[model samples]
Target chain A: MDLTFTDAEDGFRAEARSWLEANVPAKPLPSGDTAEGFARHLDWERSLFEARWSVVSWPERYGGRDASLWEWLVFEEEYSRVGAPQRVTQNGIFLLAPTVFEFGTPEQQDRILPRMAAAEDLWCQGWSEPDAGSDLAGIKSRAVRDEAAGGWRVTGQKTWTTRGAFCTHLFGLFRTDPDAERHRGMSYLLIPLKAEGVTVRGVGRLDGDEGFAEVFFEDVFVPDADVLGGVNEGWGVAMATTSSERGLTLRSPGRFTAACDRLVDLCHRQGAVASDPRLRDDVAQAWMDAEAYRLFTLRDITDMVEGRSLGARSSLNKVWWSELDVRLHEAALELLGPLAELDGDAPAAIDGGAWMKGYQFSLSGPIYAGTNEIQRNVIAERLLGLPRK
Target chain B: MRFAFTDDQLLFRDTVRDLLDKECQPEHVRFAWVDGDGRLPQLWQSLGEMGVLGVQAPDAHGGLGLSELDLVLLLEETGRAGLPDPIVETAAVAVPLLAEVAPPELQAAWLPGLVGGGSLVTTQLGGPLVACADTADLVLAVRAEQVVAVPRAALRLERQPSVDGSRRLFRVDWQDDDAVVLAAGSVAADSRDRAHDRGAVATAAQLLGLGARMLDMTVDYVQERRQFGVPIGSFQAVKHHLADAMLQLEFARPVVYAAAWALATGDPDASRAASHAKAAASDAARFVGRQALQCHGAIGYTVEYDLHLYLKRAWALSATWGDAAFHRRRVAEFVLGPPDLPDRPSRSEEIHHG
Candidate 1:
């Protein structure tokens, strides 16, 4: 029933808060999807790496501080509270690293993690393709065994590869056994985008950033060492990735709480607290929703510490926080009124149109990492024992 | 950092849950709807014997001195069973406030009887309406920053027909001379405020259980009932609705637990936490109730079916302390400062929108 953090955790929070307060960029960096911004974010990422705060929850062998989960959460809260730059290295550090830790070979972990921690190697996910967006098992990517070469020859096109133009490598599912079941036959592979036959075409996102891309591979040679989990076992391994993606790894409650605080500030600045009761209430509701998510994560982390499995409950978390993110941003935009539509460059745009940009970004939350519709199906079938159609 | 109940707390909850499962089934609830008092005395006595009624009362008052955190889960069990009693009004709100702010003479007169289940107690903390006032031996009412304890004999009770037949609602009329003032001034105001929070959080926990029960009933029903030559549960639309319902309940559950913890620890944010809990739980339960009925279709609309019992109870309790909108306003005040306008719309107008 205890809710207070341990003194050590409080100390960890204080330390992280001080470090972030001092080091975070005074002005926000440009979106990392642009080349110049990508380079700028890399410096920030390296600064975090230098402080050993980049992967606080990872093992010290991989350049992390080997912090506990509670400490990691504390660090995240502090990081968000200080309004630090978005983690440009998140695709690798948060999403792929957890999978790599769980399913990567010792040699692979030794080779991959430190570089990821240092942001020397940028990784993007290649899960969704032109035909395999929500129905990910409908992946058409193939990898033929090149036994003579001691590897596989991969040929595929992966679309909606986030930050693909900027990333050096990609991790995706490729069919290795065509004859197996729909969920079977796939292999999780880590492919270098710099490889000879690989091509990347940046796709414009709603925010007008080249954050999305279509990656094409023409018989790119990948060594057997690059396969994660195992051949024909990619479905299971990728499930682990999706769970972490939907769960605490990619989106922690800290991000939303920070946004909520900003939303409250926006309301106060606009005098909406006195002018519009309904909008003020919306701001408060958003704040409370954020707090609820924070409390939810505490219970969730408690369960993890107690050795309980999250199972399909991660879907619940996904549906909640994603929608909350959208609502928080929407409230900010409501306060901005018609000026919400202005670009960051516009003089009249409030907060450099950060709320507008954020609202656009939040639109993707329900669509990516498995659509909310699909997550709902998973929740009903797996979590609530509903029958499959 | 351990945001979970201890083994002892869970054990106590499990005991009450098992007792409710055995003795307070839907049939017992149905019986209460037709019964004059809308109560099951035997079940109430069983809860008293299990120390469920006296969970927050002092040890000297024939009770188990436990915190709200220990009793909250049990309260959820009561809601799940739709136990058709004013346990939230009595055990959770009235008894605790009485134990805290009642004078020695007042405490001696009522605490033992209330704790021992020899007397029934109901309170009016939110509005003019009082629940189960007809059956309660004592009615604790908040009046102008004073907490007055009145014997049922001294009050005139006008029954107000409610959606949930298992609950007896009334508008009570009483004279100041007939009631004893338990506490006055700032102490009374503080205790009254705490009681409101307690009532809200307790109702939030109950709504969680009631929503859970409705969802379960709908899930079970959908699996058995068929449509278009297939089980209705197999329909993606039906499943999605149920999934959304489950999502609401799941997120709201943690909020309720945290609110209970905040109250138990007397956290400075207890008022806001309680309001947050009530708002979240009320919204979740109301949403789940709608979806549950939608998923069940015609069968759910009937009184013979079990879903309506929980659904009705959830609807009643959602508005019990202060409906979702009221609590949300409180949270709004906690986050954004109090509204500056004096000519704001009345509570009824706001409730209409809510």
Candidate 2:
């Protein structure tokens, strides 16, 4: 119940803050527009990995300090306070790493976790297909067994694969049995993007960045050892992955706090509408929402540490914080005013119009992981005990 | 760092809960609302006898010297029982403030009676409008730079029956030279802040109790009421609504507890935490009350039913101390700094979204 840190925690906070102050780059990683810019961001992520501060929560065997959740929270708070680069390996480190630890074979954990921790093996999610966005159980992509080849041939199209262009690996779901029930026959697989049959096509966003890609797999052979958990248990694995994704990674308030701080600074530096009451209120509300989300996350983490299951309550957190992130970024745009329209090279370009880009980017937040509508349904049914439709 | 009750505190909570369960049933509350003085005299006496009223006051002042957390637990159970009394007003409000600021003579005179449940006292909170002033034994009236204590008999009471059937509002006037002035000047603001913090936490505890009861009532009703040849509780819609209410209540409870912890532990940000608790609890109470009534269908609205009593209490308690909007604004002031005309955009021009 106490929000203030204890003396020991305060000492750790001081240490973390000093380290972050000394090490955090003076400028943000170059905006992920050009391939070179994206690569530089990856390099910065690798630097954090080299420093052993990349994934603050992972065990030492996996290249982290094996810090307590409280310590991890403090690390995030310090990292955000200093405007450190957002974790570029978030998809691999935050989402898949936890899934692999829980369900992957020991060998799988050993092989993948270090690479993930080191940012050596950048990863992209292949969960959402064109038709199976919110209803992931409806995925039609198939991975048929090639017993003679000691593998399965995965053939499917995954749309909205974030950062798919530069990623080396894809952890995804595919239908293993065509005739089985929609959710039951799926199998989770880890496929190398460099495999001969895989192809990635860039998808241009409104901001004109190819941050998302459509990954196509044609008879892409994935070894049987790469299968996560047991066959036909992909639904459960996907649920685990989705829960972690939706609950923890997608709505990390620490990240939002940093962004809010940056937005406030941008407003101060840009000297346009810095004193706008409406904009200030928007920013203030965003900050408050972020704080609330942080407290809620702490409560969830406390529950987890105490062996209590989050269950559907995580959906409430997901819905709440996702909307907050969207609103916060949208506030940044309003603060920018006409400057939002300028991108890249315009004289009025504000941080390459990152606020505008983020506003557009935030739109997909509620759409992905699970649509906000679906989340509401989850809250209503699972949390609220409503009748099924 | 521990967010749980101590063993003694747990026992105290259980004792109060069991006592109220046995004595202050909703049926009793309903009866008292219609026939008696809307006061549970026996229940109050039972609490006083159990020494619950003295749980948070100093031992030197005829009290137990318990923590704010202990008081919150008691208040929460009282709220859950729907026991209509001045436990909060007399114990939480008047006793604590009097212990802190009252003249030595006043403290000696009032502390023993309040702890013994021999006298009831309430404050005249000058909210957006100052309506309630008459029913109190002593009024904690706020002037520009001072909070003066005036006897209730000296002021006039303008009876205003609220949505909450158990409590009434009053308007009073006071011009007595003998009236006690507790904290004055800068001390007044500090005392007001402390009282506001305590009021916010207490209100949150009360809301938690009311919200929990509404949830329980809704679930029980849904379980019994048949729809389409089955209990409506079996319906996912009803279940989900109840689950959502449960979520709100669960979330708000911890925040309220946290606020109480902050206050007891002397945390620097106790004010902010208290405001957070108030805002969260106020929202939960409103949401849970409406949902409870909705789930119970037509029977919930009837005066004969006990559900309305819980609803009335929720409404009244929410407006007490401060409402959700008021707390939100207070929280906003803390986080965003006070509204500056030249520094922020006008409210109308802001993009509004939920």
User: Which is the leading candidate under DockQ?
Assistant: 1
Residue lDDT tens for model 2, A180-286:
88888999999889999999997876657777889999989989899999998899998888888888654566877778777667756656465455666566667
**Over 4 Å off in model 2, which ranges?**
A179-181, A260-284, A334-345, A349-352, B1-15, B103-105, B126-136, B215-254, B288-307, B341-354
The local lDDT score (0 to 100) that residue A142 gets in candidate 1 is: 97
What is the per-residue lDDT of model 1 for residues A1-389, given as tens digits with 9 covering 90 to 100?
Answer: 88899999999999999899899999999989887899999999999999999999999989999899899999998899988988889989989999999999999999999999999999999998889999999999999999999999999899999999999999999999999998999999999999989999998898899899999999999999999998989999999999999998789889999899888888878874445778877888889888988988998899999999988888888989999999999888888888889999999888888999999999999999999999999998998898887
- Highest lDDT scorer: 1
For candidate 1, the lDDT comes to: 0.90
- The models' CA-based lDDT, in order, is 0.90, 0.77
| Candidate 1 chain A weakest lDDT stretch, 10 residues | A271-280
User: Deviation in angstroms for B190 in model 1?
Assistant: 0.3
Clash number by candidate, in order: 0, 22
